[model samples]
Target: MSQTLDAAAVRSWCSLALDALGREREEIDAINVYPVADGDTGTNLYLTVESAAQAVEAVFAAHATGTTEPAPADAVRAMAHGALIGARGNSGTILAQLLRGMAQVLAPPAPGDGDHAARLAPALRRAAELARAAVAHPVEGTILTVASAAADAAEAAGADGRKAGGTRTDGTRTDVAATVRAAYAGARAALDATPDQLAVLGRAGVVDAGGRGLLAVLGALVRALTGEVPAVPPAGHRRPEEPAAPGPGSGPGAERDGGPAFEVIYLLEAGDAAVTRLRERLDALGDSLVVVGGDGLWNVHVHVDDAGAAVEAGVEAGRPYRIRITHFGATAEHPPEQVQRAVVAVVPGEGLAGLCAEAGATTVLARPGEPPASGELVEAIRRAHAREVVLLPNDAALRHTAAAAAEQARTEGVRVALIPTRAAVQGIAALAVHQPDRRFDEDVVAMTTAAGATRYAELAVAERQSWTMAGICQAGDVLGLIEGDVAVIGADLAATAEAVLTRMLAAGGELVTLVLGEDVPDGDALADRLERYVREGHLAVDTVVYRGGRQSVPLLVGVE
Candidate 1:
């Protein structure tokens, strides 16, 4: 039975591709040794398809809710645009152009012209050609090789099917599923042969990561059209890129070789002529120059020593924004082979920062009235000199900043998890359970759970008269805040601290942590008084205190 290519089929392909990539992300990332050994190819492909799927869904949603139905061209174009805007690394940028090339041939489906089904072969063929053309230095044994092979196989399949009397020359439905299956089969075959073509892959003892990702995407396309995934050859399953602390008899490693220092990517809005010149300039600057997308928009990717110069060339050509810079040698600060994992915490005061550092954390100090920027957090993560990291931004206002930092680190091939610690006390609670020997995900879960289970509070003096949750108080009055809001007001700092403690311990607590600032009325005396109050009232509650040093906020409190 033959199938016709419709808008629904295209939507399904995008969603299926995303799902397949998601399942294969870690494996693909592990095998990524080409261009640079900073592993992230699998993750990049998944993010690229995720963006495309979102755009396709948006088109379908509009058709479902509005009076007008979306056409096949609309869905395809949206997918291309989404990929262009959201493409991640080198492979992702090229993959976006490949999909865009397909749109170039199949969009605005011609009536009585056999629809998209008949055009699949030509679309794929063009996708391969365009993708190859987009790369300044097109190398075989990568995703480009797989894409080209897929297109060639699809064309060959169509030719054979026509001769076997399965022709659709009279403008009837074509065997779209057959075309997809052929493409997937060809990509799989090409993926297996990648090691022979690329010396890096051969040295790494793995197939091209980018090629494997493309194979998975093609497998999804086949699944969309045929209701079954293509049967890909099974390779001996093993993880070769898992990070481990340097030790004898640990990790199977490839031949160590250094490449470019940084990967710089950005979306540029420039004319084709400007892009042509920009390509030539960027090629001279570094390797892996994939200048994809066109018609006044382009996604630029390159690896270079001077990341600023790569971005500046885009500025000379046209407007480039969403600039992402990643140093390839993320673990340069530490011994290369010893690269393992670390925790990066943003703490407000010197005392907290020192405590975090003592617990084996890479601490980013946040001075009073100055929040750490996204770049600072990124640098701190890099300074940790580990392949994997857990980030704790111990302030409510820095959530967005922390998320952005995490995303930026991910592009540089660093696996960073951001734990939303709303206060320094929460960070402390999370750090208490930090176990580096545990699995990354397990450690993150333990930290997040501990942070969430703790209740945090702060005591400060009102600088000026203002309305409070308790009542309006004049300047110099003490304010007791539980979870960032004023809950009690008093004339004495020690009295206000005790009130906050009583309110927090009412629900029951096993441990109480107090960080007393320099402004505390006799730091040692205030902590002793609070410790006594907890002992006398909330029996069995253990208390720990730290000298917070010079800080604007008088006291930091937490109950767990």
Candidate 2:
């Protein structure tokens, strides 16, 4: 009986879903059993959804058209598209793909059918398929599995309804309320079984976080349809603060020689002519102009300094919509002290933070949590007052943020270098050889070389079933990675650790340093076994440092 969804319902569902994800973000991250402890799945999924929600809200406000039914297909499409470009980690990417597929199915036709429920059934099915395709290899007991089950259930509901003469031909049939309810039940059931299906979840005593996030979104959608808000618990994660207000010199007419401090964002609703003119005007103002979200609503995000001017320009173009202006300052800035240099690292866990700090890094930004903003990073470096700054973005997810920080710092006349270190182990290795007194260029070259020479080894669980370079990884298999590549897969952590160690030392290393991670089993026992290998003349020990805390991975630094 549902005809079309209004903007408010779409916004409400998205907000409810995000609230659910915010409550359980950390628990999902902890289920990462890969030798490396980059638990960012929960965080990534939440951010992806949050971006979509924001886009939906912007679109609704710009259009200002009222409807009490289900959300229009175009609205869903805009939200999906926004999430696609803003997606961060692997989980986020997969979720974005799912949204993209769903959007395609829900795309309006030439005639623009008003049957929202009918369109959604097909969209949900396509979403599942797209999500499965996004992964190199699909795995059960994961998000893919949950989505697939939900899609199948929805399809089944459609089929049952069709048999009862409720559906129509051309795939534009209506009356999907029963199907949606059935799909939700199926998805919830699948989510509950994730712990038993995946060993990491079993160990962590939780369901698959990504799967849970998808379930939350689905639950919200069902609630919107049924007019009943499900009692979904909040997912545990950091709440993103509302965008800050424009500063004293930050309004529309503000002028600066370099540019404004933050990027100004606003949504515009007008005809095509207005949009074209606005685009040309904003092009002259700043860079990174992403003007998306169509269907009488234009979601505008631009990097500009003159917030007031930008707002004026937008207002002049068309009706002013939901306005959110964030000030993203320049990336690079000069430091005061010529003797000291700062290195900013993006690593997870306290143990890695300690290691980076010991290695002359002034600041260590934790991952799988709220990463420091570019402005914050620049401020941190400026506070350190170092002459030259080096950024070690240990997590690949933080690379863009680090680059942005570096860019802002450079703009502020700070000497900053961003070393593309992908893992915490690499960051630690790079730091070991960093010479603070050396020339900046020389130090960068030396650190890059050291990072390349280092190898990583750790014991963890496989998050999904995929064919890695090492072998076929199952849901519960304990995995070990060497030099950023999967090295071993087995149930026994000690055995896998031994295999990784042997491979790392097979290159005839002179000295081996093993830094045991927090969740590593029996550090002393593992070290003792390694000692026997050293005594056998296989490798020499160079003082093994054991730190009991979370880190990227157990590292094996080969000292020549």
Candidate 3:
């Protein structure tokens, strides 16, 4: 084994952590009793670490052309950044902050030749501190307490090694392997004692769910450093003397019994000062509040009755994207066993999100510049809380991301089918034909047929001079693209849209779908004009226009 911690070790650590979490996820979820008994702590931790692992792998991929692998600092920083933006629920949010803190200690570019092993103790300590600070109200006997105990033990071990002449009382320096082993041992001890420290765990006859998850992570770290996986029992397997009782706020009345009605999470871009104010405002509106990230980007997670108010607060702070709001109140009423099927779609705007939600699909909002990560898509699939799910990516660029999410969901026992809907308009067509009551394969085929039959086109304004299939266009020119290629360029938005629609209709169409973006001035007038043109030119065709607010393009046309 390598004596010093390095880039390869960080990569190994991430992969190992993800594996460990995957093994313990359901066990940990079964014992989830604190913060909220939604029973997703294990899954949340696994997803958070999966994001971190992917980030580290991306860093390695970026350096593949070089002579050497990425530096340890670069790898660790990538891991931290990935976790921040991709974090899911409350436990996931706190886990992101903890990784960020560790990265803060390990990612410095300068002071390159220091003892990396010695830094592990401080990194653990810093991680625990940052995690506790991120929570609105830190409670003991949870992941926070487990993390602190791990740090304390790692630090004590380091001290003891130094006291012994810094050479194991021999002639070799203390290695990272020893530090991680001590931390894992400490976390395991803390996890075992959590039931005594928290009343909920005691009543449930289980250790803290988050604590169990942290132990798995710490155990993974030990395996990454040394080549031995720590022997940690699954939470569900380790029953207390008494039969396990249902934890408080767990049954059908969880929401009514003082729990928040919804779980709101979003990624925000704001200045530090703005984020501070956002924290204050969110704290008053809900509980389980966690805001993690820095350097102008943040991930906000909280539980509240007014999901809109929580999101509005993020907007006031700055631009918030990839917004996800899940209704926990309804979850208690419909257990996982009861849900048979669901549709998960990626929409571009809040208006479209509302539209999809009304159609009984769980929506993941994709902002103009910021797209939802694969982890976010996976979380959305989980949130759908169904036995089978049909995923509509709605954009060609997201094909791979959607595929990866589908694979992940399948591993969690969700039957997922990925439909290649290349546009939101196509997604709309698919949703129109979605019938959850039908057989899963039959439903998927119907949605796919609808999406495929819809020929889509979009109208966008050029941001800079660019060459198109039709001709070269200058900045501020109206560009019309058909089926993902530029087909028309003009000075007027309406004229360009008409030209594109004419081309699409030349082949013959029965139905026309017009989605108007929020930015177009007097959008209603433009929609009316387009509707009139379609009606006049194609008398046999029907027209439908929708207000696709704040979408990426000025107009989207779909002909079927």
Q: In terms of lDDT, which candidate is strongest?
A: 3
Q: Write the per-residue lDDT of candidate 1 for residues 73-160, one digit (tens) a residue.
A: 9988988987887787889998999999999998865657546787999999999999999999899899999999999999998888
Off by over 4 Å in 3: 1-7, 60-68, 112-115, 166-174, 236-256, 332-341, 368-382, 385-388, 397-417, 435-442, 458-481, 485-503, 516-543, 550-555
**TM-score of model 1 (CA atoms):** 0.60
Two-way lDDT contest, 2 vs 3, winner = 3
> Which residue pairs come into collision in candidate 1?
none
The candidate maximizing TM-score is 3
lDDT of 2: 0.64
Clash number by candidate, in order: 0, 36, 0
TM-score for each of the candidates: 0.60, 0.42, 0.83
For candidate 2, write residues 1-560 as lDDT tens digits: 12244445556667777776666665665543211124545665676777777667667776676654335665777678667544544456567777777777766652445566666667888888767754544567778888888888888887787788844554556565576688888888887777578644454445666777787778878776666555553332222331234335432223222544555555467776787788777778765454543456555555566777778888888865334454323211211335567777765666656677777676544533234444446545655567688888766666787898898788768899888876666777788888888889999999988776765555667878999887799997978876557878888766676677677777766456666666666777877876675656562544355462655444333332
lDDT of 1 at 318: 99
RMSD of each: 12.5, 22.0, 4.2
Candidate 2: deviation at residue 275, Å? 30
lDDT of each: 0.82, 0.64, 0.86
How many steric clashes does model 1 contain? Answer: 0
Ten-residue stretch with the least lDDT total in model 2: 328-337
